[model samples]
Target: MKEISPKEVEHMLSDGADMNIIDVREAEEVAEGKIPGAVNIPLGLIEFRKQDLDRSKEYVLVCRSGGRSGRAAEYLEGQGYQVVNMTGGMLAWEGNTE
Candidate 1:
């Protein structure tokens, strides 16, 4: 699994880079705020959504902190999906969330 900082992810989103972002945080947390266009698939739901998640593209996993995303990234990587753990997760994200 790869590791990406908030700055890099923010830059990519701003530059309109083609990428998939998944928020591994809980639903209530996402209800408070979340990256624009990010998919809200909490860590607990990841297993059931494995096949639904695209394997052809890279996925960025995020959480309140970095722990959950780290695990999510590892799992996706093991499944042959190109995924990255968003370092510092949402706490360090400078991007707008709504």
Candidate 2:
């Protein structure tokens, strides 16, 4: 899986990039704040649950400080999904959130 900085992601969003961003962190961490519109599917749920995610689009995985999501990305890639990990995770996000 490839790594992408949060700042880079924010810029991409501003430029109207179409991306499928996923928050692989657990629900508890999501309370801290997440990139707006990111889908929440905890890392443990990635195997059976990844099917809920779209395969036709590109996906970016995120988690607290970048650990969990990196693991999720690797798993998704193995599942044949085009996945990228958000480097630094939400800790590095500098844009608006929900």
Candidate 3:
């Protein structure tokens, strides 16, 4: 799986890249805040919600830190999904959140 920095992801978003941002944090953690357009799926729910993702689209996985998202990225990659893991996760993200 590919690994990308939060700043790079932010730049891509600013440039209007058509990519999917999935946050693998739990509901409580997400309530604190999340990258503006991220879709919260949580690491535990990824397998069950795999079908909710589009195989043809590019995806970026994120979590509180890089660990969970890294695992998520690996799983999605194994499933033949085009995905990248955000290194350092939200802690490293400097972009706007909601």
Instruction: Point out where model 2 deviates above 4 Å.
Output: none
Give per-residue CA lDDT, model 2, range 1-98, as digits (tens).
78899998999988998778999888988988888889898888889897787787789888988988888888889888888899998888889989
Worst 10 residues of 1 by lDDT: 52-61
Q: Which regions in candidate 1 have their CA more than 4 angstroms from the true location?
A: none
TM-scores of the models, in the given order? 0.96, 0.93, 0.96
Query: Alpha carbon lDDT of residue 97, candidate 3?
Result: 93
List the candidate numbers ranked by lDDT, top first.
3, 1, 2
Candidate 2: worst 10 consecutive residues by lDDT?
A: 48-57
By the TM-score metric, which is better: model 2 or model 3?
3
Instruction: Pick out the ten consecutive residues of candidate 3 with the lowest summed lDDT.
Output: 12-21
Any residue pairs clashing in model 2, and if so which?
A: none
50-96 per-residue lDDT for model 3 (tens digits): 99889999899999989999999999999999999999999998899
Candidate 1 has what TM-score? 0.96
lDDT of 1 at 90: 90
Better of 1 and 3 by lDDT: 3
